[model samples]
Target: MRALMMPHRIVMLAVAAGLVAWIVLTGNWSWLPKYAPMIGQGVWRTIWLLVLSVMIGFSLALPLGLAQASGPWYLARPARAFCTVIRGTPLLLQIWLLYYGLGSLFPGIPWIRESELWPILRQAWPYALLALSLSYAGYEGEVMRGAFASVPRGQIEAARAMGMPRRKIFARISLPLAFHSVLPTLGGETVLQLKATPLVATITVIEIYAVASRVRQDTLITYEPLFLVAAIYLMLAGLIVLGFRWLESRQPRRAA
Candidate 1:
């Protein structure tokens, strides 16, 4: 296993080195220095979108996932159906539906149109945030549900036998175990959520992808801007992976 893993790691490093070398050799680096500030702002926007959406999504996922996993039919069924619908549908469609479809109808409601919140609702960010949050919640909720279910029954039973309250058992044993089990998966989902930020560009959020697109249009150099954006996203994903790996390492190891 060590030998096999060593070779795979070497190959990955070699591929990354080759790509960087190629980009440096062939690409125009001048544009980067000139537009660094704009690109930086775009990157910031992308990061904001990812952080806000994922935080909101994960916050909501906790309860929704628990409901789906353990609640009565009245609660679980609807929660399950909500997750199914959001996960089954394409995210882009959800964004469009929220941004354009519902946005168009907002004016017909005189109260909403006249409210102070109307200014916020008129912007693309709120809708994009909502859509992304809902999308993340739908997927993450299922992951959480599965993780919760995968907790060892023996642990819960032991806690109960000790006369621990249900809430205490859940808080001390079940939630932590499930969370540890699902941490890696949640990390992967976060990376995926970062990728999904590009979709907000369609609704005029002006994120990294949007900035790259503008650069391409203005300079008429398609590949350069795209390549740069790809490199940035790759770096961001690498950081996210490393962060998760560090968290995983800090977690107490399971008994053999």
Candidate 2:
């Protein structure tokens, strides 16, 4: 117990010392306290967008993934092709296309012609969510499709031999096993999506990075707010990883 205690104390002290050194070098703690609320607001926006996009992406991907794996080639092949194109393109391009390019093409879209939807599209948040969700869905669809395909042929055959309907076998055996097999991948994708949230700031969405940039611009300080934002991101990402690790641990270990 004493051995562990000493090392932990030393690490904590070292971290505290490093932070003090950073504050001394930056020389703008006063400004931080003033604009801290703005930063918090930006973080709130980021979290809202992240959660909304992830939920929407996952909800759409599941059915699309299952369809890709089990539907006819006419449906599956197109979905596969769509996924390929989306995954191949950069997300920034996708955002631009959806927000600007498409808007130009359909200037008089219904419910958007001098209407509320136009205002929504003109803002950064909706476009950010749209781009993030669509991009994530494309990647997640592939992961789900692959996971579904990995269901053991033997088990499926036995279920069929027992006269189980396709729907029953899929619901009872395939979906559960596929989810378990793909959990780690899904966790990783979620992490990637979280990281991508910062990119939305480029479009004027006041995410963490955007708020930090505003601070930098106003205070003419280069690194302080950026460092703080980085720290916040690291902490949030760590929590996500820990949650996924807990979930993974709770799952029964497969035979070696």
Candidate 3:
């Protein structure tokens, strides 16, 4: 794979200059020092939440897409249904249901409350993470299904003709091709996933958006905090695009 893009030095420096100018010249800075630590924590939490959920969701998408694309009817039907339902529903509704409905249900269950995992089960972040991960999986599952289906049947037949076992054939051929097919799309999905991280703030996760909200509440300066939040997300999305473009550049070359 191509090295992950670090982005352009000149453009990045210019953007940095612009942001610094904005921070210094335009907005209220008095509150920043007091809340700097909280903002730092929020930024870290947002990035962590996005990265972990995407990794978990993409891992799930592989099997889910494969099941729908090529597995037996039983597996395909359920996988199809899952993708349909998740894609159909509003992500906000799913988060609320999981956090309010299932979270409340878990506490009422005596065994769950008594279990060793009760502490984790009581928190909002776990539910938020679950909702985000499943949302990513649901969307990416369809992308992967299409990618898997597009893999040339001739390639599979060639491998099979060479006496390659089914498992080996998939490892050597299908998965990689499908992943490469979807690599460009995966970056866009990741950017969407990053935007979705703000939704977790509604569940008391205290991500960067929530930090912005707090700044607005405490300082009553709306535009400055919002400007910063927008800038942060914009930078993140740019990074994701550049990173994926680099991956696309690294795709294996085929000889004519």
Candidate 4:
């Protein structure tokens, strides 16, 4: 296997090296140093957007996922519909709806406009966050639902036979197993969410992509800032993959 993989690995490394060389030779390196702080802030904003959205999304996803996996139609139907709608629609449209559609209406509602929360409601960031979070929840909820369903019925039955309380069975056996099962999917989803953060730029959130655009506009040196932004995203995705690998390693390996 190692012998077969060696040639592929070498080719990949060569391609990567060549791309880096091309970028370095062609890119505006001086602009990079000058605008590094602004780019860094953009990276921070991207990270912040991803973190906040994923955290809130996953929080909402848990209950929705449970409801989706549950036996009752009443609970499952609404959850399924929510997932369908949010997942079906374009995220960009959702952001626009929240930022422009609802945002425009906020001032017309006298009570909402007068309230302290109005300031927060009026900001592009809040709307962006809401749209992204809802999108994440819808997608990740399905992942969670499938993960829960994939858990071994035998193991759950064993727990029940042992007189474990329902909540205890879920906390101790079901939820953990499901989480472990879905770890890779969750990691992929997180990376997708990171990619999605750029969409917030449409709503004036000023993330890494937006900063890169601004830099390009200012310098008229197109590839450098954009390349740097791509590199940053690649680094962030690498870190996420590494984090997931570390987490997976920490868990007890299941029997073959």
Expressed as tens digits, the lDDT of each residue in 10-77 for candidate 1 is 89989989988998898876677778898999999999999999999998888778888787889888
RMSD of each: 3.1, 3.0, 4.9, 2.5
Query: What is the C-alpha lDDT profile of model 3 across 202-234, one tens digit per residue?
Result: 999999999999988888988888878888889
Clashes of 4: 0
Q: Give candidate 3's TM-score.
A: 0.90
Give the lowest summed-lDDT range of ten residues in model 4.
Answer: 1-10
**Clash pairs (backbone) in predicted model 1:** none
Candidate 4: which stretches are off by over 4 Å? 1-15
lDDT of 1 at 203: 96
lDDT of 2 by residue, 151-244 (tens): 8999999999999999999898898898889888888888899888888877788888898888878878877788788888888888878988
**Which candidate do you rate higher for lDDT, 1 or 4?**
1
The CA lDDT at 107 in model 3 is 80
Give lDDT per model, in order: 0.91, 0.84, 0.91, 0.89
For 97-142, candidate 4 gives per-residue lDDT tens digits of 8899998888899999899998888778999889999999999989
Each candidate structure's TM-score, on Cα atoms with residue i matched to residue i, is: 0.88, 0.85, 0.90, 0.90
